[model samples]
Target: MYSSRNMCLKWLLLLLIAVAGGAVAAASSAVRRDGGVTYDRRSLIIAGRRKLLFSGSIHYPRSTPDMWTSLIAKAKEGGLNTIDTYVFWNVHEPQPGQYDFSGRADIVRFIKEIQAQGLYTILRIGPFIQAEWTYGGLPFWLREVPGIVFRTDNEPYKFYMQNFTTKIVDLMKSEKLFASQGGPIVLSQIENEYQNVEKAFNEAGARYVLWAAKMAVGLNTGVPWVMCKQDDAPDPVINACNGRSCAETFVGPNSPNKPAIWTENWTHLYDLYGNATRIYKPEYIAYQVALFIAKLNGSFINYYMYHGGTNFGRTTSAFTLTSYYDPAPLDEYGLINEPLWGHLRELHAAVQNCSDTLLYGQQTNYSLGPLQRAYVYSGDERKCAAFLVNADRNNTDIKFQNRTYRLPAESISILPDCNIVSFNTAKVAAKCTERIRVPTMKFDSPMLWQEWREVIPVFDSTTLRSNLLLEQMNTTKDTSDYLWYTAEYEVPADAKAEIKIGSRGHVLRAYINGRLVGSAHGYFRNFSFTLDTTVLFHRGVNTISLLSIMVGMPDSGAYLESRAAGLVNVNVLGNQGSKNLTDKYPWGYQVGLVGERVQIYSMNGSSKVPWSKYTISPNQLTWYKAIFDAPGGSDPVAINLNSMRKGQVWINGQGIGRYWISFPKPDGMPSQTWLHIPRSFLKPRGNMLVLFEEEMGNPLGISIGTVYLKKLCNRYNSYPFLGFSSTRRS
Candidate 1:
């Protein structure tokens, strides 16, 4: 009995020692909390030990709050220690004076979810983020404000920016959501990629940046403030890089000292021109991350899209109405791109293992070629990590240091322990299924016609009102796609009166008796052109309807600023289209569609729409309605609008997307064509299809179909995920 008691006491003492040691280590590992800032480091020198930190980005409005916890949980599983997000100004303050923080737009809830996952947060309050968002996330009302030049040192612009930024800062303070106040947000970003186009503004551009830095620093968020793409970032404002190869985009000219940060490591390029079908190789992306870490020093990395979510509702902006393509890994439907998710997870785990060496150590570079290079982050001579890169567009095998490495086209390689090959840039073996829309039925159903009439007198109203005559980009806003350019005309009988109309190059359907005479659109040309005079009268009250439709908005540099996206000049022509008609007439105008006032898609909807049954009719330019039960399951659904002309489609009052069937032949110019129906835009019951058809076509020919990714058979390598092996197939 004495011997047993003695043994038990010894065991108890050992357990107590272990517990105390762990407590000390944990206390030391407590993140370096200096003021409102936390260094994203690998270890805390409590007594002297190493730890790991993980992070991710969760744009609150990208997904609903209901999805926040699950999304953060997924990030945790993927070994993320932080959650980063850009606070969208448009989504938060949708209207002037009305601030919304509820629902999916709840920034606080989103950070709390990240905190719950034991993760830190990076709040990028760009207030001016250009994430392919509409108007670059600015309130539409700003456009209507007089003399407001955005991103410049104009009074109106600064006044609005200050008010909005202050509101956001105050809100965060109230919620104690900043790391400085024990909130999860450790870092806050001010102006977005301003330097990308700053050269256009000259001195004002430099001045605007200085003012932005001062403004952000003055907020006193108790955390570090960063500005991505700004090389001339002022003191105390850390400048970060953003791009596909951001690991190389240097900190702007006059700035140094602050830690280098890869603010947006674009895992996959976002979709453009409405294709949304391009799938990037997962192995390639993993290699990119590994290579970024190896090449980029100072140890801060953030994936632009850790999980690319759906662009629900009207949030999906387009260069044209039909440009809905995003080549992101997670796709718009929230589907986990298998090999991408898996391969990246492995890469993250590998990075975590070398966190200590990468975070605190200095990296030295060794050259191979412009594309191929090496980065060694060393603590001790033998204890080091190496990264080999081959960003070559073509495949090449390099024998380096007595080890053979096969480099695929556009890839990077990571060597954690110098001798062992852990990850390669080219070896992703997953076969990307190029999804095609297959016709389920052998023959398309019979057709029904519809006759529609244009409200011709729409352009002849006395009160010609535009949201603002000449509003600036991201300012005057997107309240009305149509701008009323009212001018009257006097038709001379012998003068051969003709109306030559020119617009910003969009759909312009003209009318005489309010009867549709002819239409001109910019889709076929950079700008639209038309001439008509058939409905001439003896100089009486003549009305003309010029429906100007906004195909999409402009997104680019300063020259695009003055390029004019709507109607530029209109003239009255006579004498066989070569002569001029009455030079002057007071024209009236209206903006947007006639149906916008009825809240056609709103739930508290006033109009009772009958969508369930189908009817046959000969209608030109008419609104067609159809209702069908949603096909069960989570697979994506697409409406084959091959038979339909140009129109806007709504599923359950939610815009499934726009459809334009006119495929421009190989004219050597891009055109608006094709349509995609995302499953996220579907509804189980009362699934409505509202189409504002521009031409006469059979709506009955339209049918909803499923788009499935077909398995691809590779004939090259015998790899399963990438290439297929056929040697053993009998």
Candidate 2:
């Protein structure tokens, strides 16, 4: 009797164990399926899960392949599960039909690095990405193509775009970087934020949008495609919102079967040209995020710049009226943007705690006030979550469900248990460092007494021996800033010494025997200026040298198509700047920099060029070479041209970047001083410097120094000033 009773108990225990095992398998299956989408809602479950997604945006060409690993690891530590990037077209193909993907242009290696970190990838392939990028990501070669207009259905434009897009897609496919192939990229974008400027394009714009969607769909990556800022995207494409408050931003009418997503939550504004503004505060950012999540039915949201990296070399875009890079959370030096980073991190953690309810459960809103609203999502009695958000900049306190919560000027509130407030936007206590890098006021050399020499005109009007007019962007193709428009003006036998020179606009420099007599640029209503060539013109075969510099081009507008660059409607005005001469005469036109065609810089690395002895009267056109060991280990090196004038700099033959020590802004500040030295733009052994100083200045005083964060400290309860935060005690 005892044996029979024990046998029955054992069988009962076995049955219970099998049931538990089956339940565990079912839960695991649900977690895996939650990541992707399906045709029917009944086939999928949204609630009862937690996700660990890491993300960062590192442009492939922004930094070299050597720097990719370290960058990816840094993102991982910052709690990123994904790496996001926009494929820049200009950097990929500067010249048409010439495909080069080696060195920093290696997008394949960039993704492989992200995959190496065991992280997912978000590929934002906007051939028209306006990340403050030059030419809006269109290659310079594209503009030169006959009858080709950008972002349209023009066959030439579409053909080129399709070619490059498919090339990149194929390259990634070969590397198996798409999720369907068991790789990193799970999301891809088409035509970034087009709806914002849709009216400008009209039907062609709508057709282009459809074309972009169809093209992307044709790639067949097995993952759903996304169209950011498109309120009317076609079916099967998930239209995502992009902006500071995308939570309330709606989906496109054409595609309604996908979940809502916030492609970009502007953590802070980008840097502007003038005085750099500080990023938004952490509490403010947190408040914004809370508001976005609470007000909208968003299933997923991504920061516009979770990590803003450096724009090394000429990678920075500056075509705007003034250079406004937009002071982002991360500065140009790639330093941590503290308080901002911390406050957001805390908010992310809080949101994560309730991810199950936020991602899966139904959202219900409660009106707290005129501008205040709250959202409650309950997965279970113990797993309920709540949020109170005030979008206004003014402070607001609301009473809800027998409890009162205070909302800061522009912030949010999070309640994990639904009944108790665990986090408040006005109450973030994270610490941050406040610091700035002061420009080197002085260098080792003197400010003045260094160099002076004039550029000899090798290709003057008589020297060229040809009469033609070259259009600025078209003929020269932006290879050089200066285009020589010269003609031999016959002075009347009974002539006054001065000749009145005039042009359609200003920005003309008069030169006789390569001497800079005078220079003029358009300032106000009048673009035409004067050049007193009283002694400039002579009898028989005289050369008139005009150096026209383009300040900035027409970036956008209907009139952009009509804007002209270089000397237009040029003529020499005589009789005390009255009578014009050589108005209709045939003029000789020569394109590009005098030094460029000569290969004066020798940019392709060979051997270190020798430095010439310091000249008492430095020649204006002569190139100067200086060698120095790369300013200690790993610290960024910069040359203080503050003492010198305008010139182009080359390190070990590679163009480090352009520098204008004296070209201060309208605000009376230098054009730019510090030249950031990236690890990729440097050489290990001996480093060389070559400068073509147009306006000769001090060369001996030019010194190379390192750029490092001056101070690293912590200030408590004030997060989100920059993009990072510190856990250090205040």
Candidate 3:
């Protein structure tokens, strides 16, 4: 009886043990299935724990695919754990119903490359990305959509925005790119800085933000969504702050429940055409980051452009220079910007050391003095971390917790143990300077040139019409930049006539009887100019042709379609009564320059076209071509357009960028003159350099050269601004 009772008890125990084992196995699977990222009020939680994320913005389209992996690896080595990028709508869907995702536009390949390096991604899928891109990254075709209003609660705009967003989200879903699908993408952004200008659209803007948040949440990507610079962002959409001093502002007023996330800590200012280079101090940037980590209870900080690559092609804003180098850690050529890069790396490391204490500890703040403060975070067992900040222009020593600490002006000091100072923003722990070695070509070896004439099309009575168009964009639809306004008027005798032209465009060149009269251009706005010249008008009729050129179309603002370009109105003041020729007489309109129609700059069908060996003066509109041996090796090339006036340069068949040497320099621009040319675009034997000189410039001074790293220098005087230097004659 005792043996039977013992056997029954053993079987019961065995059955209970089997059931517990199965239950444990099921819980493990459930945890694995719930893999993804989430955030609390304190920090971002990943794998069921808080994670410290340092991300950098490196737009995939800005740099080549071959450079993506190396750039990302460099970022990771610099202690970055995530890569942030914006999905450029203009590059992907250039035309309606057509898409291109190959080569530089292959965003999937870029994200996968980031994942391969074990780095997370912040997908800023803003269909309206305004990163100094042409038309602010909105497709040019959108202008044709009837009854369309951009970035507001408009049916047409919302329809297209939703379509594109859905398309992109579906693509990522198919590739399993979201974090929920065991992929690298952790955060997604919907709108970009919409709050700043939302008031312009009034009630529609508020409705648009709510609609966008709802639409983003509806996508169900299984990751938290962010609305950068949107203070009034609704629930489920995290409102992230932007700008240089984001830490000082925190996460704005409404979204206090969300974790503080700095979406864009501006490393440096963007370069504008005809402006001086803006240099930002590395120490200042370091201090900002350290202060942010010490003050804000957050886990993520992203640099606006850790690597501000080249604009390449016509992707740049109308007012922006060709080189999109924002004085970032990595320049346009993918070279390390020394102290800024290294110093920031050290700062990131120091912040990461105390991340745990910062995320989990209770925080206490104390005011040391005016513009000075101390913050302490204490965890379990009295383990503490501290941040000492001095925002004054002069250094100061302050006593905190019975210990004295010296803080540099406009700097922050991080104490991981609340005692030992592990890092200080003002100290130069890394290389403080960098020198660039640029290879100069022998001045004696001047490039030989061939010339071609751009035939100006004459508008006869047959093509003439009596109506001036409201704007160039509406008439030309952005197909060309040059527009000719030709009109004929009869004069009693040879008399002085004042040809008045009120133009909103950038440049205006006047011609009488096919002869150049005078030229005038505006600085930033439209201005009226009068040409008072003696004209030899024939008894029958005299021809007057006014050529108007647009630097770039209006890229932003409301009712951009209504903005006028070219001659708004023209008036002729002579011995007779002044006549208003604003859409009155037979005004002939020409779309583009004759050279563009013939593809003269591209060297296509050059064998059949007539060529001249004699060099012509740069006073008139002309096309200059030169055949020279390519600068050998893998070094990037740049043409010194120091002497060339305002125009465009083309290497082989690729258009480099627009050059405006005649434009007066804005304060802060360095005296340098070299336009960068990618090595991949050059050939070994024959390379064609074509210049469509508009105003006036000597092409003889043009030279080919290479750029290389020299040595480190102070942050205030980093290598002369990235684009063409103002110094003429190289």
Give TM-scores for every candidate, taking all chains together and pairing residue i with residue i.
0.77, 0.80, 0.88
Which model, 1 or 3, shows the larger TM-score? 3
How well is each residue in 1-730 modelled by candidate 3, as lDDT tens digits?
Answer: 2367654654454344335443322322232336666666676666667778999999988888878988899999888999999999988998887998998899999999999999999999987878877777888788889998888989999999999999899999999999889899988999898987787887667768777877877787877788888886666577888887766665542544467788898887776655566665677677667767767775688998988887665567655676676478887767777777888888888878888888888988889878788888999877899888887777889998898888877777889999999888888666654435354542222337766766555558325355654466666666666888888788776766777777776678888888877787765433334444445555567788888887665566665435667778777777776778886566887778777767776767455458777354654677777777766666556677777777777888776777777765665332235666766667777877787888667777677787666655444443443211221110
Model 1 C-alpha lDDT per residue in residues 1-730, reported as the tens digit of each score: 2357654654454344335444222332254434335333332121133334344555777665656776677777766778788888888888888999987788887887787777888888888887766667776676667887788667788888888888989998999888667777767899888888777776566667767777777777766677888876665567777866554445432332355577786765554432332334565446545655665453566777776664444554433333322334343434444455546666777677777677666688776665677677787555677777776666767766777777666666667776676766556544444556554321133222222232334443545444322321232246544443444444545343556665555566666555566676654225445544454534554555556665555443443324355444555545535423223344465555454445455444415443323345434556665556666665656666666766667667665555555534354322333345555556775566667776665676776665556556432233323211111010
Runs in model 3 lying further than 4 Å from the true structure:
1-33, 250-253, 432-447, 461-466, 524-539, 603-608, 614-616, 667-672, 712-730
Q: Write the per-residue lDDT of candidate 2 for residues 168-224, one digit (tens) a residue.
A: 788788888776677778777877877766667655666676677777767666555
Model 3's number of clashes is: 14
lDDT of 2 at 310: 49
Candidate 1 residue-wise lDDT at 691? 72
Worst 10 contiguous positions by lDDT, candidate 1: 721-730
RMSD of candidate 1 to the truth, in angstroms, is: 12.8
lDDT of 3 at 356: 84
